[model samples]
Target: MSLFRKPQPITVIALRDAPDLVTSLRRALETATDAERPGLERALALTEDVAERPDAELRGRWVRRHLDAAGYEGPADSVNAIRVLRQAEPGLTLLQALTYARETAAAENTPL
Candidate 1:
């Protein structure tokens, strides 16, 4: 049996308070060969664009919007975020922060 199973769909949510962190995470995910890479890339681009906007509230709302679009519906707390990711993708073997974000987004049906 292969430990590396198919990647599940995921959603990624970031608060406006952490746009830079999210951008860096997206850059890292862009180099990933995992199935969630494409979505992450898309989310990254969206996040980047949102980050560039002038309004902070709008930026946060954009993050939430993307998360919703991606299918996540949890709060942006670190603990729940990790739980959401783990629950969504059992094959998700890595413990990296990006992986958590990706998995969390993919598993939930609402934005966090």
Candidate 2:
């Protein structure tokens, strides 16, 4: 233990998928970097809200907005940002974040 330091509070969000169904994704989230796990959850909440729309442009725009909010943006078509967002938000699974953000995506966030 560090005598001169304290641990920061991490926001961990559990998933609602069958444990076996999302075993891999669950482990990924569990072992993800402290910065990543919650960020991914945030992205999922954003994706779930508007993923079924027929508006491709709107989705893209929303993705951009979320990226900005999550501080995940970089150069145009940032591969890193896309990779994180996809993995964080049910990219290859049917899981859902349990602790959904209280406010909708349009609301301001306190920097996760």
Q: Judging by TM-score against the true structure, name the best candidate.
A: 1
- TM-score, candidate 1, is 0.30
Clashes of each: 11, 0
In angstroms, how far off is 85's CA in candidate 2?
A: 1.4
Cα lDDT of model 2 by residue, 1-112, tens digit: 5655654432333233433434455556777898888976665555555444334334445455656677775642445655544456643221111112212232323254
Over 1-112, each residue of candidate 1 has an lDDT whose tens digit, in order, gives 5677775453333436547767686678968878878877787777777677544344344444544655777763355554544455444434443454544344444564
What TM-score number comes out for model 2?
0.29
- Superposition error at 5 for model 1 (Å): 66
Sum up the clashes in candidate 1: 11
Model 1 weakest lDDT span, ten residues long: 54-63
Displacement of the residue 84 alpha carbon in candidate 2, Å: 2.5
By how many angstroms RMSD does model 1 differ from the true structure? 15.8
